[model samples]
Target: MTFGWLITRYMYPCFLPMGEWYRTPMDKNGAILKIDLADFQPTQHLDIDPTHHVIVNGLYMPHTVIRHNERLAYCDSMAYRVEIEKNAPIQLQGFTRGLAMTDDTIFIGQSRMRHVLRIPHAFSNCCLDGGIHVYNSTYRISRFVSLPAQQVYQILVLDQDFSLERGGN
Candidate 1:
């Protein structure tokens, strides 16, 4: 996967891969607290239960590392809570930075940048097609739903701990 020596040394916003650990909120016990999907495709629905261990950057914490396997798998659990809550109608206008995850997929969107990225490990097995798929904002994704986290607490990126690896970014 090279683009010739002339362009190898030069790149824009280049990113290198690590062992893979998605920075997300986790409990002191190393378990994911809760996960909510941003359902962009409202017309369609998924039979996903929130009380399950979902994939995150190819790892779903304790079990994944414990299983000695990284296969995309989902299992119902009471330790962690997985929920899918809807958005208040996606406003395609302005720079809206949104984040949400489902039992299978994780979606991060930047409306201002007009880009939406989808990362799925357990949701999809095409690891050969690894990494995220960025789509233009014009495309429809009415299936996004977020949890009612705002009413309970404010989201602060600095206070969040979605990373298991430190100082990588």
Candidate 2:
């Protein structure tokens, strides 16, 4: 199975002020590990492009990985990029983390990095905010809904019959 792993080549403090966090150089990247279940060993490793680390002020933290139509796809959180096995990374608008998909749509979670200093980049110029971005089958954003939260860590797609009023029974 493929697993998302944090590849931190350089060590940094667990906590730091916003300004310091941006200034500090941390070689953080993400990888997809192909694990051999029988021996619990990683048989292969696919690393995210190294250029991502140089383009962003923060780390290239990966959030989620899933199989879609027999292909692997994952999110590079702080870099705001999504990658499919054989496709180029898709640019996004925020600190992307959560990801969910239906037959014809994709949902990506955006988090507000309020305390962290962000340097503007080609992917996104607007300020990061907490929300869910909806995309169509072609991967074009359809809509965005802002939330009153600091971060959106995960997303779960529910069936048509699912209802919160029934307590998800």
User: Which candidate has the top score in TM-score?
Assistant: 2
Query: What is the TM-score of candidate 1?
Result: 0.16
Worst 10 residues of 1 by lDDT: 1-10
Cα shift from native, residue 150, model 2 (Å): 2.0
Instruction: Find the candidate with the highest lDDT and give its number.
Output: 2
Residue 25, model 2, lDDT: 26
Give candidate 2 misplaced runs (Cα > 4 Å): 1-28, 38-59, 118-126, 160-163, 167-169
Q: What lDDT tens digits, residue by residue, belong to model 1 across residues 94-146?
A: 22232333433433332211112322222321121111222223453434334
At residue 45, what lDDT does model 2 achieve? 55
User: lDDT (CA) for every model shown?
Assistant: 0.25, 0.59
Q: Please write out the lDDT profile of model 2 over residues 1-169, one tens digit for every residue.
A: 1223332332111121234445432434333333323333357654533333322223356667666676656677667766666877767867787887776887888888654545434443644788988877575647888899868877888887896685555
- Model 1 stretches astray by more than 4 angstroms: 1-30, 34-59, 62-83, 86-124, 134-169
Please give the lDDT score at residue 31 for candidate 2. Answer: 39
Quality of model 2 by C-alpha lDDT = 0.59
